[model samples]
Target: MTAHPDRTAEGVWDLTVATPIGRIKAVVEFRRRDGALTGVASGAGEDVPLRDIAVDGTLVTWKQSVTKPLRLNLAFAVDVRGDTLEGTSRAGRLPASKVTGTRRTTPARTAE
Candidate 1:
């Protein structure tokens, strides 16, 4: 697993989720401050806040509240290859589903 130098100590991650609801894509922005992770989920008219984001190596876990007063417990074990992130996402108490996502690549910067 490779880490991106451009990846913020905390930042947003765009993910694609495969569900019975079809393929839903969202941007989950995370901030690591004082060993706590916090962020928001943006997709399907849902901008839900994420709580208790935790990262152990390449594995990430968090909780997101749905609009219907329900919450999803998500777990992702990501392997970074270049600009792509391959992983699995499991929602709530269901079994994990295969997921693959790419990070939006930005142009390399030149030293000023």
Candidate 2:
């Protein structure tokens, strides 16, 4: 059976990227479409669409742009294992930075 969005890897990810300056926390969300992935990655108050999204086995790759800190694009490839995501992020042609994140848990809805 296909996994539901509520209980699958195709949901919100709270990620942190390790840079020479410091660690930056970001948020991303993934949705599976026809066995492929499409989503938005948010950083520095900008929500950019995930481009060139590719999935192989348990690994996924995507890219987005950052406008606040500077004008640069980031490419990310991550391996999803259980509830943890391990991966690297690349900014332009610079060396890749370590990226890690965990799936965010949704609280149960309370009926009013």
Candidate 3:
């Protein structure tokens, strides 16, 4: 069975994440392949696949490692609400950074 679009984090999202150096803007795309939740985050001229993606109801969490401006192992936990998501990301002992994202919407195609 297919999950409802609003209830699932299976779409493209624009994310703004706060970091010690500065705020990093990224785009994350979530997908379900072979009944498994998977995702990828692209930012800072790098595209990295997310690991350990877990979803429960409207809560989604994943781990990602980014190497571009710098290298850091990140863990993300977020709550999806309709078209928006709010969450936090932590890197080791560093303070958690606020993560906010909006689902990207595509215009509906009309038959000619």
Candidate 4:
């Protein structure tokens, strides 16, 4: 079997969005397993577990939920380009919020 190379979205990313309440921040990390994608979105006083993660080319989608301040579940659809990610997070029937951020570069790995 042939192994594919890593993509731009397969690393820790620092994301932010401006909302009516205030500017929110989240750290998202993604990884691929057996042709499937999985990740976590954490911030805003809570850590959220992502679900239904899917990746296609430069596009990625996932679902995350929070239960603090309120019970809310968000669906994310983002396009990864270079070191930037831009997209929206939809909550039910409400309008999607603007989501944008830059990818965080990780330190070089050392041989064991």
Q: Quick one: best TM-score, which candidate? A: 3
Clashing pairs in 3: none
Model 2 lowest lDDT segment of ten: 1-10
lDDT, candidate 3, 1-112, per-residue tens? 6456434898889999987888999999887788777889988888899999888878899999988787899999999987799999998899999999999896222479
**lDDT by residue (tens digit), candidate 4, 1-112:** 3223345477788988655565678888877778666677778677677898876777778898877555778888888887898999887887788889888777323479
Cand. 4 Cα-lDDT = 0.76
Q: Write the per-residue lDDT of candidate 1 for residues 1-112, one digit (tens) a residue.
A: 4453323324556688777667777776665556566677777677888766656555555666665323565656555554456777767678777666665444222479
Lowest lDDT block of 10, candidate 4: 1-10
Off by over 4 Å in 3: 1-7, 107-112
Candidate 2 positional error at 111, Å: 14
Candidates ranked, most accurate by TM-score first: 3, 2, 4, 1
Stronger candidate by TM-score (2 vs 3):
3
lDDT of 2 by residue, 18-107 (tens): 987789888888877777678887777888888987766677788888886778788999988767899999998899999999987772
Better of 1 and 3 by TM-score: 3
lDDT of model 3, residue 18? 86
| List of clashing residue pairs for candidate 4 | none
The estimated TM-scores of all candidates read 0.64, 0.82, 0.87, 0.80
